[model samples]
Target: MIEEEPRLSAQEMIDRLEPSLSLKRRVRAVAALLAGLAGAVFVSALWWSEPDPLPGRTQLVFALLTVCCLAWAGYGGWLLTRRVPLFATDRVIAAWMGLAASAATTTALAAVAVQRGTGLVPALAVGGLFVAVALVLAVRAHARRRALLRRVRELTGREEK
Candidate 1:
């Protein structure tokens, strides 16, 4: 006779947050490592093998944004590996997203300042705007995730009772 695996209870599932590494964490770690590698490669490319000084404002802007995007992707990976309570997961994710966005914005500002050969004022203003927009998006996504989780809990609770 074939043996069947025993199912864990909801409490057991909740308890598992600390002990076992979830699939999400593993995936995030791998993805983050990849993204970090990619960022390093891009920075190196811009540094070493340049044919000439990039000639125009548009090219500079695009390059700066590309770097920021890569960095943010890596940060998203970091958020994926974190452990948080079911009810608080949305908040935690949003916080991490905001943090990553801020970091990206800072990096972008630095790039802009260096490339433009100008003062910090313009860089800071543009970067700050990018960060603010990212934060707003993160908050909205968190709210949606929280609502979905709440509905799931309600359904599961009904089944148990």
Candidate 2:
């Protein structure tokens, strides 16, 4: 006769796994904090090193967009540091990051187009490509989130809704 091992309850499994999970969370939080810091530094460097003087209105808009990107990255890192459930919130954060990146790229491309006196057609094409990439990234993030949730539910012996 083949012997089968008894399955542990969710609580029991969690209790046993909590220590490792806590460690993993701490490591992830540290990584996020580092990434945020690096991004801030890079943006600052780029802003500082710009060679030409921009119009007051253009400078303000650029500053605002850069700040928004830095803020979003910092907020995401902070949330990760707080050890919020990854499967629950990480996907949303990832999507937001993707959107932010797309916006920044669009802004940069527009600036380049203006500086180079390029026609609208090339700029529009580039913008379209960026949008397509962003959409793919967002979709992948959501799909990964769903997969993670499903796996968690399976591990806990819960039925999928």
Decoy 1 TM-score against native: 0.41
Indicate which candidate wins on TM-score: 2
Ten contiguous residues with the weakest lDDT in model 1: 13-22
Candidate 2 clashing pairs? none
> What are the per-residue Cα lDDT tens digits for candidate 1 across 1-161?
99999987765654443323457655655666577667757766665576666667546655655565566566556556556544435345545655575766677667668877877876777777867877777776677556645554654573210
Query: Which regions of candidate 1 are displaced past 4 Å?
Result: 1-40, 48-104, 107-117, 158-161
Point to the candidate with the largest lDDT. 2
lDDT of each: 0.60, 0.65
lDDT of 2: 0.65
lDDT of 2 by residue, 6-32 (tens): 998765654443332366555665665
